[model samples]
Target chain A: MTVGNTTTQRSADATATGAAVEIDQVAVRFRTKKKDVTALRDVSVRIEPGEFVAIVGASGCGKSTLLKLVSGLLRPSSGQVRLHGEDVRGPRRDIGYVFQRAALLDWRTARRNILLQAEMRGMPRAQARQRVDELIAMTGLTGFEDAYPNELSGGMQQRVALCRALLHRPPVLLMDEPFGALDALTREQMNVELRRIWRETGTTVLLVTHSIAEAVYLANRVIVMTPRPGTVAEVIDVDLPVERDYGQTMSAPEFARATGRIRDLLGATTTAE
Target chain B: MAAQSTIEQPERTAPAGATASATRRPGGAGAGLLRFARNTWRPAAVLAAILVVWWLVTAADLVKPYLVPSPGTTLDVVLAQPGYFAHHTWITTYETVLGFAIAIVVGVLSAVVMVYSPTVEKSLYPLLLFAQVIPKIAIAPLFIVWLGFGLSPKVVVAVLMAFFPIVISTVTGMKSIDPEMLQLSATMGAGPAQTFRKIRFPAALPHLFAGLKVAATMAVTGAVVGEFVGANEGLGYVILQANGNLDTPTLFAGLIIMSLLGVLLFVVVELLEYLVLPWQASRRTDATTTTL
Candidate 1:
């Protein structure tokens, strides 16, 4: 874990970018009415600047919990989560999050939804408007800026959610299966769009997903976790080309091999448990 | 294969033919207007039928005239002795508006406090429930005794009658937000106050409006009941006076006016809801278009 941290920091510094996040021996437990359930145990991961890392696990593997811990929405029962080497006792403004559901306020238009995050951060209206315009154009939402969430398709609403997450230009983006609710074809298209956006913005992204192909295709490295009292099972370096086209990459040998290995790891863990 | 071909052919041809036929209808705007009228005309016709039935029932003396007077006689009473009920109606309207405004302010403030402090909610919620459960009419006389008969007693009665729904509704609205949304806001480093203002408040608006609509209708009834208890002015006082004299037409006239006021207030609330939630309207319109 120490070696991993140094490598992460060295690489982060070498790239002239600061260490974005560090999670040191983090553990989370939930006390229900009946019993205490351990969600994550002895999980340590360091996400370097500009790295796209995907955390992949089956249900009950605490993947979402890990995302929450890093985003500072939940504190680890033990260990520490740090942003830029500073302890994250609570949520930080430098990290943006997108949920599986769009979760757009039904009453607000797409433009207003984007403005919400900006407003919460106390950005002036003039600055917010400029950021909103850039995001709308970047997300291809120029024509539908005034449309409400209910007026949009599931895919479009998710795009709006993505734009909202990007509005503040956070150094780290935490996404928990943002495309999970979308249809298969739309989800695939969203994956392609997300990769494009991530590359363009050079933002470090920590995404949690159940799809092995999705994790393998998007991440520079995929962290696999064990189920129930989840710990990092293995961290596999994805050797596929960084710049990817969805259709072409899926058929590439490297992509298939990476996906197959992650799938086998997941299967082995599931069967063992 | 042959049957499948026949089935598939019509499936393709029917939609194409239908589209062609629809486009061939040159007066599309007129047809659209005709469709609109056809839809609206049914409800209008039903209302007319209801009015006719009501007039006939009253005209034929199917029910006691004292209970259900003829529409003409009620109208005549309204026109000739309009001043008789006017003062009372104005008084009731004033009480309703004033009490309703106070209820809104107090209810919203309480809701904010309750949401911010569980202790406040825990302590006050049961008391509110107990107050709500009490028969407001039974307390009307007590209010008159305590506050006197000028306007204070009546307004207090109106407030008591209409306060519960607003508070309960506002509290529920303030608390009922998506957990994920709260999480999102929290992760964005938003504090409690920011969370409430930016996320929870806007999200709870539909629920708040729902409570307001119910409260508005109740306000009218509250004012009338308050007037009935002990007041020299207001529609309720006039109705009570008419009843004492056995002037059935005048009583019916007052009742009709009160009913109209209630309907008018409800419509105003609905109109406000429509204005405040235009996004809801657009969504509804979208749903209709998609269904069509």
Candidate 2:
């Protein structure tokens, strides 16, 4: 199965520029007793240095699978996944991931949770402490640094997750619906906070989400996907002004147009399949 | 749209007022402490009342002294022959403590190994199950026979009794991590060792402690059982001696002392839990308030 040429070329370009992540015609399939389920069909994507890109799709569209490919958590059945021009055979240290759930260690305080990443990365304790302080401040979790995951609100816990993810300053951040578990209000607030944090840190981010509005609000470009055995259906550029305020920018005509195009693509894909 | 507007408007207004109030009460220290006390006092009161009832029931002669000796008589026996019980009590305490330490070390190590290797888990887990199913008392005499009636047998019994719970709890705790957490750690370029130490171990601690608490109590019982089977010293041995002489009051005293020792050990474990996991307490508070 020849994966798309565009994805391969993009990956080649990414390799040249030392792009954070490059997925070149990557295909992933799972074998069960009864059947082989192809999760991604020659899907290819490239994330540039310091770009915020969102992958949006319906359920079973292999959005998470795409993320796993990029994170090197899963190998492509055929084709290549590259990071900094090197084929990513396993998890790369230069990428940070956040999940749908906060997934903080219950026994650890927020500060400890953030430090855990540093400890694993073998970052010196003294350096970790300074970084942790900066992260706590950036996340607006100064007072709750010593609070446990169970003690914080869903939004707060996610903030801790973000801090932990960013602690090591990995060049690429892979977020799989990191705010999906929060309530609508909390999710919106998290989106704003996330955008602000991303701008300040200047880390390239690949966010997977089901919400079109969210994809539009946070990403420079939104890659829409089809149903199971997923392939990229469309890649829409978001032309809205950067440095957004949630209240002022969310209602802009450009924002609505981008969301509309994504929604239309999703609707078409769902009906076609 | 109206609902969204209403929600947004309240949130904006509320944050300003809330921040002002929060700053004014910086850290919420006094109020937080008061709430903490308020929540804890009820449980404390109930426990005190239970103790009082036991005292009153024993004093009222509601049951025969042989069956349920008066608290006063039990106390007198304890005070009168402090040395008599103290020496034996120390023996049991030593055995219990030693066995418990061995169990913790072995349990944690085995759990870590099991998590890392499926082969080890497959082979050793069945053996653990087999060991746990056997009645500890039934093996106490065998331990005495094998170890030759010294402190070794008692300690062996205690270790055997305490080991299973810690292993099971630790294993369960280690395996119970959320997939997302692992993914997050992996994406952050953390290696296997880093993932486990930072994520799995800390996440599993509460469960591990739960098992440890149960094992602590079991360790004491194992020591006592060991003394009962064959031992020159310990509260259990004293009970056997008092039984032979028909000194019901003294036997009751020994039982009371044993109970006290168990309670004290359990309290020490609880204290350690609190010290190790201070964040848990605040989390519990947050849960209560949010639910309300």
Candidate 3:
């Protein structure tokens, strides 16, 4: 509680003002000719700017649906999603999205791939290049600006994606299991890099993952979701220092408490959706 | 120490993938020869066996002299009349090349149109299928009758023969783009044009070149079919004349020359693929070979 950082200070400030993202009683359903599938229902979350929120759920939980709502990639059957207090009507241009796969353009170099966000937004060339340099440096992708996605490692590709997402410096970032595809050690290393990047950039992030420990370690608050016709089962506040060391944070009581509570919540609902 | 390790730790991931790929990659000169032989020896031996049988069938006079002709006789026929054969080959090559260029433009444009408009796809898909499924030989006479015995009929036949492969391959390529990429690009504020240009178009190149290579061979056959029906000048005309006059050596020479044209165009498309898609060719080439 005594540890102070700009990330923590800005997080506190964001709560007093407008929320960065507000998912109000959102429900999403997909209908086919033969059947109707309810993806999510009665889901609500309020994410403060500069806050890290992780939604932990098993496959088919619609934790990913929650992110789609915020990004305006999907619409809820009911309720509403708002970004920066504005209702999301269509695909919102003011946000960045990272997927499990880095989704880097195979033909493009890492720098050019990152610049895609800028080019799409019509950002000034010199300004976009300058911002790209900053992100490349921040992500430790300095020397590999010219490498294609195929030439890069899984972790490096994800870093390029992270840089691309943060290029516009949007107020909110949405990640769908951004580190899920990496190996265990690489995933941990990415988790640490992501935390540092999040602190440095101070962008509000909504991350969806299946890993309980990942949610507890990287997020200020964890939203545990139930499977199929998913809804928020519980919200866990990880009462740990804003600046977390991998070894220290993993061993912290708060981390264990948060993870334990989430495991129990997910475990009980295993038999039914 | 933590900060120093952070920089170094991420780089460790790089070497793991690099080394794994290195093991799969074609090896040094000595190892490469072994792998090359493994992948290619069967095809080489099969071709050699066919050539020997062809020579024996002629040498033993199992067939009439004018019916099969010796391989040496066919070679002499080509060597004796280089200018005459060259003129006919040039005509066919020109017609096929022109038709192939047109096919690429039309094929790609139509594919783009079809992908963007479901209505266009629905309307044109059946016609495209029919074009591909129909025997070009059966329809060659129709094109010749409609356009007459000249460059126009031969070129038209070549276009019809070649364009379907390009269309199908190009459509598959454009549609094969990861849907997630489209969503991500949409979130980035890319409009349809921007998405197609940056995400869809470049992603489709490797497939498009693949289509072009297939189309290259088809175009040559189409041109020859056109000549088979009606032509004043071309390798097909040479072959037709030889067949009528029972000049088996000329007939064999014409067939070889036409096949060489197809191979030449195929090689050209391959070279273009390498130049245009430097990123894909290395990985793409490796996946095609069965080294074991």
lDDT of 2 at A173: 90
The TM-score leader among the candidates is: 1
- For model 1, how does the per-residue alpha-carbon lDDT over B233-256 read when each residue is reduced to its tens digit? 899988899999998988888887
Cα lDDT tens digits for candidate 3, B1-292:
0011222223333232322222223222344344434655787698789888999999998998788888889899999989999999999999999999999999999999999999999999998997779888888888878888889999999999899999999999999999999999989988999999999999899889889999999999989989989988999999999989989999999998998899889877866665566567545545675463
Q: What does the lDDT come to for candidate 1?
A: 0.79
Off by over 4 Å in 3: A1-17, A271-273, B1-72, B285-292
**For model 2, what is the error of residue A128's alpha carbon versus the real structure, in angstroms, after optimal superposition?**
4.3
- Per-candidate TM-score, chain A: 0.93, 0.94, 0.93
Strongest candidate by DockQ: 3
Best by lDDT: 3
Q: Write down the lDDT of every candidate, Cα atoms only.
A: 0.79, 0.80, 0.83
- iRMSD (Å) of candidate 3? 6.7
DockQ values for all predictions?
A: 0.27, 0.34, 0.36
lDDT of 3: 0.83
lDDT of 1 at A215: 91
| Model 3, TM vs. native | 0.87
Worst 10 residues of 2 chain A by lDDT: A1-10
